[model samples]
Target: MRAALKWVLWDVKDTLLKVRFSVGEQYCREAERIGLNLKPVEVNSAFRQTYKSYSSRYPNYGIAQGLNGHSWWTGVVQDTFSLCGVQDPALLQTVSHNLYHNFCNAQNWEVFDDSKKVLEACSSLGLKQGVVSNFDKRLEAILKSCDLLSHFSFLMTSEAAGVAKPSSLIFEQALHNCEVSATQVAHVGDHYINDYLASRSIGIHGFLLDRDNKYNQSGIVPKEHCLNSLEELPSRLQEQMD
Candidate 1:
């Protein structure tokens, strides 16, 4: 039954690796470096609000509306600080620029301890792995700096695909790029709707990585499809395929 699954697609953020610093802490650090005294907690809250607003109004980094990752994220940073009462356009620009470039390197991210093991295990099982994430073009650089880029045969980012999660087009593009049938692949990610439901909607086996037990009682995803850690993945795939 191992032949039933030929590929394993993964989601990057929150599944494989995550930003090492909290948005609030990182933003404050950058802001403080420019001689601005800001509270991390307040900055973080403002960032969350600004992020949700941006995601709703301009999904996929506004790729559909002709905005790229740099433009979209720059707007977010500028507005996040604006919400915090930083009215200096020059200050906003400087902080946003610093934060944007700061995120594209390894110092900004930390790989989950279980991630490498799972990737290696899947490789040993003869399964090809690739990325399907809602990240921007900077993902390749970030992954490379983290030493995780070599594992995947391909990387599909929403900005590059011109489509994002919760939309089946990105997954379809991933399949097309990999030249594989939906039945031959499985996708693992942390978001319930974007990762699990989205991939499954197109006949791909979907697994939800619930490292924090956030979905333990959501009653939305099936228990079998939910994993506490990626370490359960290879064995879980075997069980499902068998």
Candidate 2:
């Protein structure tokens, strides 16, 4: 029989908390506040392109290349604005810095509607929780700002773990921190490969939060493990323990 679940590891981004505004909108807002003019649509598109390029070039904040989280994200921000026609070096620096620090504020993030209720339900069930996210160092402040910090016993970021999801090392580290066998834990995340498969590979139960039904027809995730909302989770855990 599967071991009783003692813990529920969480993925922060897109799982519990999401940015309150589009990157383009937030970036344009910050720039315009400082007297610069830019189109939200253009800035948003540029950011997506730049972010994808940066992720491909520097996976996990490019730690292997001696780049830390701040430097890596700053590069992405600067390049994104540059692509959107912000040519003045001083202006780029100013906006990039503002945008970077702005993300750490509570105004930039929102907790999912169901997150607190599910967390409370799990807590009532006597289970501990921790964060295992592919996020940078700003995660704690962001979580705190969203008032979600008290729910977790620990926070593990890619910056701290020196590894990111889809890599077993971070999950291994979470397992160690929990001091429990893999079978006694479960992970919930929105990403298919990163949160679900990665944890399952090491024996932790995996639950995919398919809020958009993106994977419903993918034929990849098992039907039992796919969840449409956080509300379904406490019951799932109860079923597992039975």
Candidate 3:
């Protein structure tokens, strides 16, 4: 028989934290504040598109990787601003960079309500909680500051693992951190292709968490077992208990 899962690993960002669009807003606001004469919507839209493009281009690198991954997004903003006939690329990037950096270390870290509820339940049931994410190393400090550190057995990031998701080695490392075999742990995440399918490929239980209605576009619909919020996990546990 297989071991009942003793570990619960988290996917950071949208799964646990309420992602804010404020950084994008701040970029536009800063631009306007200094007479850049650009529309906020344009700035925000460009940032989002560029952000996805950058992430798609480089999955392994993150924020502290010296803007190596998402610099393209910043470049998009700069280029667009120039196209819109705005002067001062340096000021725009500087303010935007500061806003992004400050957001990374912000004290008012917004956490998902579901994340708190389920983590509490897991603890009560004696499951070792952990976080494994494709994020920068500063994730540790952010978790610590948000009071999420203590709840986690260990926080694993791409920087520490030296690899990103959709790769088997990272999942293997996450399992090792929890001292469990792939068959024994379940990974819950928002991205179906990256987190769910990747982990599932390696024999771990992978659950797709649909928060922003992403499943509709993922082309791989999540099953009923793939929940919308962590609050639903207790019923699964309750059924197992029964």
Question: What is the Cα root-mean-square deviation between model 1 and the actual structure?
Answer: 1.8
Q: Name model 3 segments beyond 4 Å from true.
A: 32-37, 62-93, 106-109, 212-224, 237-242
Candidate 1: list runs displaced more than 4 Å: 1-3, 216-219, 240-242
Residue 104 lDDT, candidate 1, scale 0-100: 86
Shift of residue 217 alpha carbon in model 3, Å:
13
Output the worst ten-in-a-row residue range by lDDT, candidate 2. 214-223
In model 1, residue pairs whose N, Cα or C atoms come closer than 3 Å (at least 3 residues apart or on different chains), thus clashing, are: none
Model 3, poorest ten-residue lDDT window? Answer: 63-72
- lDDT string, candidate 3, 15-126, tens digits: 8885455544566666766666666677666667666765665556644455542453456556545545566767767755655455565453688877777888878887
User: Higher-TM-score candidate among 1 and 3?
Assistant: 1
> Clashes in each model (backbone N, CA, C under 3 Å)?
0, 0, 0
lDDT of 1 by residue, 66-159 (tens): 8999999999999999999999989999999999999988998999999999899999888899999999999999999999999999999999
Residue 52 displacement in candidate 3 (angstroms): 4.2
Better of 1 and 3 by lDDT: 1
Model 1 compared with the native: what TM-score?
0.94
Q: Each candidate's lDDT (Cα)?
A: 0.92, 0.92, 0.70
Alpha-carbon TM-score of each model against the true structure: 0.94, 0.96, 0.78
